[model samples]
Target chain A: MNEVIELLQSHRSIRKFTDQKIPRDLFLELIRAGQSAATSNHVQAYSIIHVRNQANREKIAELAGGQKYIADCSDFLVFCGDMKRPTDSAERAGADVIRGMTEQFLVASVDTALMAQNVVIAAESAGLGICYIGGIRNNPAEISELLKLPEHVFPVFGLCLGYPDQDPNVKPRLPVESILKEDYYREDEAMVDGFDETMRDYYGQRTGGTKDTNWSKQLSPLFNAKLRPHMREFLVKRGFELK
Target chain B: MNEVIELLQSHRSIRKFTDQKIPRDLFLELIRAGQSAATSNHVQAYSIIHVRNQANREKIAELAGGQKYIADCSDFLVFCGDMKRPTDSAERAGADVIRGMTEQFLVASVDTALMAQNVVIAAESAGLGICYIGGIRNNPAEISELLKLPEHVFPVFGLCLGYPDQDPNVKPRLPVESILKEDYYREDEAMVDGFDETMRDYYGQRTGGTKDTNWSKQLSPLFNAKLRPHMREFLVKRGFELK
Candidate 1:
């Protein structure tokens, strides 16, 4: 396989890692990759905080739903969808920066997320492992305060990066046709068929037999979960008026 | 700089292009990079529709807010947030999949965006040019029907890709400190100095000393424009009940 193909096919989330520090150059390269990502209107509404202090990492791990991997990883980064940059810029220019809506908030989140994925790819190419910690969003205000975020900025997620101690199996994806469409958006029945086979095979390998769990079984309940119920209201409370 | 680093540092959204088709292998590699991106719970709730037909590209270009470059590009891909894959799996297992709510929808949208950015990176590394078209969301329902999307799958954005015929200047980014936080989020005067200098120099080079815009001047009007004002209701209407 070519380097990109190998990178794609062999990729897996690494929650466990060996105790080794990431080289500074590789870290810089990863951030450079992230910064290079395309931003909405080229505004680049995002920021990253790298935490190397053990005490800080431990606190972040506890804050991130008690995920131990956060502290265990060699490097931890918190990605924030930031509006403060522009807000600050407005002050410098003597202009008003008005933002109290979902579109702007989502733009920042989307921008940060887009950049984070680039960081993930760059880190992987450098032989590093990464696990995204969405748990960081569970307590956005606390995480923001803990990270000392200014107003108009919110933390979207955190990433734990390090050298892998174990090689996890590559996660199976829905078939190419399921995701790749033609000229128009055609909802082909073949998509379900092909993806069902992939999921079945993936589950079979994971359980050494056909498991009752499938993609839907795992996904449906996640939406019904209590913690995620008031996310819209939470966004509103966090200054994103979903108009 | 390494090839990847150069790609990262020199990224520009090419809104103009010459008539040249991207090679199939290079196209596939870009898709592979899209697949390698992290997904929430590995659900991979996204789809890419590659449009090669000139007539179709022309129509899509028209629908994408009158962007002529889209019609001129050799290939166009519409990245979509798809919830049907898991919903179908749930139905096959006789489970309720309607739990696909707003948060889930956002997850899919974020997931697709992350993947799309990688596609852009890979394309750029191979000497291809790309520009994201968010105007697709301006009329989601019409675009959805045109793309033959089933329920619960919404059009997120469009990407125009082809070989580059122009070398756009590197866009300036806010200084590292502006977004980079220490232990916690600290918003003070310190984040502004270096960035202002960096961006002023950048703008001076790009646009003569006469008409230079800083980050704030570029972004504040977007909020005032009330773009995608009804995106929330539109999303709900499109099958994502933000429960």
Candidate 2:
């Protein structure tokens, strides 16, 4: 693999960070790199809220199930799936704008994800560490309210960026054959079993035998519970309609 | 900017592709790079369908609204947002698996986008070109059926990959101030207005002065109509209930 492919492969989410602040210029460059991602139909349906307010960060930390990094990181950003700008631009051009279509919701989320990943890769390449906080989905309505998100805008996730205080090994992934199929969708149960063993060994060694579970075993809690059941109504209220 | 950031920003959707195929080893490396992307709770909820069959590729080309690149590209991949493997593994492990939460839908879509973007970057870095065909959402059901995609899996988008047959200019983006906000969500109408002029020149020059469109005007058709209104029901049929 080339340097770019190697960089892409060597990604690990950073949780602990040093007190070093990212310079304003480099931060802006990361955002520009994000904006360069391929967007759907060139409709850049995403926004990032740079949460610099300490009080707001603490509240968001509690709202996201006590994720203290949201408050402690050098900079925290709320990545939002936003259709308002594009739709509003269309309306201003005198087109009869139809909002809240399901595809709009899907496209906005995908666009945000693509742009955010570019930001992540760029951040990693710049010797800064970053972690994506999916915990924001834990309280989307409150997070959106805190961010003052308007119609056709929803908080998709948050990110904590800073210089690393701790380093973690890159977690292994499913074998390529498991996810990449030729011509049709298929299952790879054997691959999962093998990956579970790999994860078990990694977790045990990483935590010095404290974290005992494998990947398959760990997923039980996630699927056994109806995670984020409130998100549907919350998104609809935020004008995603999703219908 | 460093080499990685430069590569990230240099991205352009390459529609025309040369006949040279990507070597199998490099192709697998691309998939491996995709696997390195972050997944929610380690639930890698996505799959890539390598469309090797010419007939299926042609049908997908038509199903994706006459996107001939699906057939002409050396490799065309259907990136699907798949929740089956994770949830099914959970169920097999004897969890009373709850399925079809809206958050699951959001996570799967985001996960797929992140992984696919990594693949895009890796491909580009390897001197291959790529295009994301969002038009696949137009007839997702037909395309899904053709690909034999099972329950809890949905085609999010398609990718066309090959050596470049055309060299297109890197598209300019909305100014950083427009999307990168401070503490709260805000509209950047003024910045967007400035970007429109930039795009006007890009589109005209890229098409030899034949094309006439700016960023805002280009978004009119996408928002003026309820794009892909059938997606909700189709997703429901595919077992994404999104509830």
Best by TM-score: 2
Model 2, residue A22: what's the lDDT? Answer: 96
Clashes of 2: 0
Backbone clashes in model 2, listed as residue pairs: none
- Give the poorly placed runs of model 1, Cα more than 4 Å off: A91-94, A210-212, A223-227, B98-100, B188-190
Alpha carbon deviation, residue A139, candidate 1 (Å)? 3.7
- How does residue A187 of candidate 2 score in lDDT? 80
Name the lDDT value of residue A151 in candidate 1: 62
Q: Residue A197 of model 1: what lDDT? A: 70
Best by DockQ: 2
* Candidate 2 ranges with C-alpha deviation above 4 Å: B207-212
